[model samples]
Target: MAIIPFNKPYLTGKETAYICQAVESGKISGNGGFTKKCQAFFEKRYGFKKCLLTTSCTDALEMAAILCNIQPGDEVIVPSYTFVSSALAFIRQGAKIVFADSYFDNPNIDADKIEQLITSKTKVIVPVHYAGVACNMDKIMEIAGKYGLFVVEDAAQAIDSYYKERPLGSIGHFAAFSFHETKNVISGEGGMLVINDEQFINRAEIIWEKGTNRAEFFRGEVNKYGWVDTGSSFLPSEIVAAFLYAQLENLDEIQKKRKEIWNYYKCLISNTIENYQLPTIPYFATNNAHMFYLICPDLSFRTKLLQKFKDNEVLAVFHYLSLHKSSYYKDKHDGRELPNADKYSDCLVRLPLYYELSDKQVEYIVSLLNY
Candidate 1:
């Protein structure tokens, strides 16, 4: 039996040609022509104030942390059911992470529970848009406004997703997006940091250029550039940008095909299976079809179901093991039992989803769900 992998990176066929063009043009470094084109695509399409390409989403989050100026003892509220980068970015800046619980019915942070978690030490609220579904941004933004807390959206899986007609990355004060191979869009490993607040725009450029003002000097806005801020080598090379631009050009077609695969999984699984909870898209959110996942009835059921997948030579997986309970953070946690976050940590199973998935493979995978 041929095994079905969890994810396969899709290529637009123009990636190599673009890379060749970038190399022939003689500037294949970060923030070059291809980078600008990629950045402009996001800015124009999503209405983001500014976009800076980074080597990875984790780097983007780190840049957001630098811009936030987090200090020791400062608290940043983050959902327990997200990637480590969401919390690690702030932790690296010496901010204590205050892990929040997810909604009982969904993987997104519980917006209603967030206000109660806020304290004088709270500096930011990091919302992770899990599986490309929008979090409750309206409520979240309202709470942030009331508390004067910054919101850095971890929109790693939320490319092209929207909340109430507003794009996900455009809602937060700062947002980070991923272009990992497994994502809807791919450059093998790439990401972007979005600056929505004008105050951080200048500082962001400096931070992006390794704490220097080189970008300004290049633009002739300054006579000379030197070390002026704090940053790291966060930008991806032009080769990655070139590959990403090719992917961006075909984003609509890619999204259309992925959404078709997502719908196929939903329709088949919903009809053939019972008791399992299908993915729920809130009325205010638009699905970007990043990955299709289902919540099994319980941890035991999920464990056994995964074994079944292995036995059948199909790849199935779980996501986010609740950072609050991890060994590194368990002792550091505030001892609050986040049942909902833990529930998702143990129960959510992502099925294979990619642009090139065929109807025959879909039927085979769906048939396995009958177990």
Candidate 2:
């Protein structure tokens, strides 16, 4: 039996061609031709004020932390059900992570619960677009505006997803996107920091260029590059940009295939809701088909279903373990209890979702669910 893996990175052949051109053109370093091409592509496509490629989404997040002036003792509101990068990025910058609760249906931070946790020390609100589903950005933004807080979107899974026809990354003051192999786009390990606010563009470039006026020097705006502020080596090699440009060029095709698989799963199991609850898509959000997950009745049922998949040579898996429940953050958790986030952390099971998934494989996977 052929084992169906949970995720597979898809690539278009344009990489080698671009990489060859990059090498032949004699500039295969950071912020070279391929890198600039990707930056321009993302900025034009997403309406980002500025976009900088980084070594990883984690790096982009750290840059955002610095740009936002996250300081020691400053509280940043984030969901406890998201990837550790969402909280740890700020935590590394000496900000205290104020863990929030998840929404009832998705892993996104519940916007309704944000205000009650606010304090004079609160500085930023990090919202992860879990499973490529948009959170209630309007509610989140309104709260941020009212409280004078910065909104940083942890849009690692939301490259092609949208919120109210506006692109996900453009809605927040700063947004971090991943190009890791597991994401819709693949460069093995890469990320982008998007600046939506105009005021942050110059500083963002400086942060990406290791605190030097290198970007200005390259543009002839500065006679020579000079160190100006504290920064790190966040830029990726041209090889990563080469691979990523290929994926970005084929973004529509990849998204088309993934959506087909996602819809197929939804159609196959839609009728099964009488026995098991299926994944719910909010009417307000347009998803990018990043992941297709189902909600079992309980944690035990989800675990059993996963075992059944393992027995059948299908690599089904569960998503995140709520961050608040982790040993590192247990003491840091807010006193308020979050039943929905806890329930989702226990019951959600993500099935295999990738661009190359065939219709026959989809049918076989769904058929096993009926057993």
Candidate 3:
């Protein structure tokens, strides 16, 4: 049997053609024609106030941090179970990261428990929509409103997913998305920052253009552009944008196939898995089939299960480690036990998921789990 890798990047067949077109356009730098197309697509389709492409999701998050004007001693609430970029961005701004726990049933931040962690120093609440499933945004937003805190949605894995009919990235004052090869959409490495608040739109462009008024100069709104604020080279090259635009053109087709694979895996394993938990999609969230992961009962069991998959010539993998307990942040963490985050760090396993994964492959992977 052929080994099934954990993830395969999907190609929509127009990537090369688009790349050639971008080359022919004579400009491959950031914020070119292709970049604008990709940005406009998100803004028009999702009702986002503004969108800016970035070199990576990490860049987008960093831009958001700068826009928030995070200062030393400011507090930013982040889930302990998510990718490091989610917290690292705020930490870079000298904000004290207040790590929160995940829900018992889902690996998303527990919105109900967030208020207890809030303080006068709290400046932003970042809610990462894990596995494209929506967090309890309604409750999270309510808490932020009551406390006068900014909300930034870490929607890196949540394109095309929604909360109560509103798009995932649209709910927060700022949002970040990824188009890494492993994501449903493929750009090899890319991301976008969505500015939902009008106040941040103009400044976001300036920040995205490396702290200058270059964007305004290009638009004839300014005579000349110069260094005006704190920023970095966050935008991506036109080649990345072109590849992403091709993927966006076939978004519906890609989503339909991926969802079929997701449903098939769930149907195959849900009834048979006695000691493990499957992903849970809240009623308010629409599944974009970004990933399909399993939660084993404990570290030992998960380790054994991973060995089983490897023995059967199938590759499976675990997800993020608890950020609060990481080597860099363990001492800084307030020593609050994030049980749910720890549980997920040890137990969660992601199987193969992509547009190219076929029914036979899904069944074969499930067979290993059954044994």
Note the Cα lDDT for every prediction shown. 0.94, 0.89, 0.94
Residue-by-residue lDDT tens digits, candidate 3, 1-371: 68889888888899999999999989999899999999899999999989999988889999999999999999999999999999999999999999999999899999999999999999999999999999999999999999999999999999999999999999999999999999988799999999999999899988898899999999999999999988889989999999999999999999999999999999988777677798999888999999999998899989999999998988899999999999999999999999999999999999999888889999989888864
- What TM-score does candidate 1 get on C-alpha atoms? 0.99
lDDT of 1: 0.94
Q: Which ten residues in a row have the lowest lDDT in candidate 1?
A: 267-276
Total backbone collisions, model 1: 0
Worst 10 residues of 3 by lDDT: 269-278
Give per-residue lDDT, candidate 3, residue 31.
90
User: Each model's TM-score, in the order given?
Assistant: 0.99, 0.97, 0.99
Cand. 3 TM to true fold: 0.99
Candidate 2 collision pairs? none
The regions of model 1 sitting more than 4 angstroms off are none
lDDT of 2 by residue, 10-69 (tens): 868888888888888887789998998999998998788889999999999999999999
TM-score of 2: 0.97
lDDT of 3 at 166: 100
